[model samples]
Target: MRYERVYVIWDLYDGVRTGVADLDGTPHYFASQYDEGPDDYSDNFKLYPVGTEFMRRAARNWNIYRAWERKFHNGETDLKTHPGHGGIDAEYDELRSWLDKQVVLLEALPSLYRAKFRELPNQEGLPGGMLRELEVTWSPSPV
Candidate 1:
């Protein structure tokens, strides 16, 4: 079977928020930058239960963000909460590190699994230079 693991990366003003969730995905996986059409861009990095309780709590937080995301399914609503809004929420660091671990796992995915994520289309008009905000996609084993 073909499966594509997806992680939504939030390039917020302070830092990045990336997450992975394999709800019902198979062990095979891949990770890559998210590509979306001009008209469709709605998907957050879902988080599965696979880490310390703190990590799980963070995953659940992403879930809550997603629920808020659904209210504006058209992708017009912005779910990002800035640190400046209140002295940079300390959780940013914790979440970032946790998310990085997930990236490490994606890098280890076999070539075939990696290809599934590379199958993204509509990759035009992507500006050059350092990218602060980007969504990463990758699949992982089913638990």
Candidate 2:
């Protein structure tokens, strides 16, 4: 018989804030691990704070919107054929609006952590790449 298991790993780092990624490379919530156990994964696995979280949420929200847009454009899912709902167009718009606010929130995370690690170097050895692979079982992009 064969079996599969799952586990979660956590990492703690100093001077790293907990939050989402921003357009400007800012380290937020540096400490944390992927949701899964030792394996191979590739993704940004870090618990973000409210502001950064909002941004991350927005990005995800937009992704959903984009998917819907593709589906609708490709005639895969339409209101006429699949009535009862107005399709995902409205949802896409709403998500886009929320994403704007999220961007604003994400922009603030860097400033919040600036004073904390101002003197320190920007790049601190964080286990993002390795942890993603170990926990998610996916290959990460070359750093």
Scored by lDDT, the top model is 1
Q: Report lDDT (CA) for all predictions.
A: 0.38, 0.34
Query: What TM-score, to 2 decimals, does candidate 1 have?
Result: 0.33
Model 2 agreement with the true structure over 1-143: per-residue lDDT tens digits: 11111121122244222333322333232222333556433233332344455445545654564454455556676645322133535654565566445534532222212211112233334222222211111112232
CA lDDT for candidate 1: 0.38
**Which RMSD does model 2 reach against the true structure?**
16.8
Per-residue error for 45 in candidate 1, Å, reads: 15
Weakest 10 consecutive residues of candidate 2 by summed lDDT: 1-10
Q: Kindly state the number of residue pairs that clash in model 1.
A: 5
lDDT of 1 by residue, 1-143 (tens): 44444434344322333334233453212222343764432232333344454345555545544444453343544436433233334564556566556645543323211222232455443333223123333444231
Highest TM-score, which number?
1
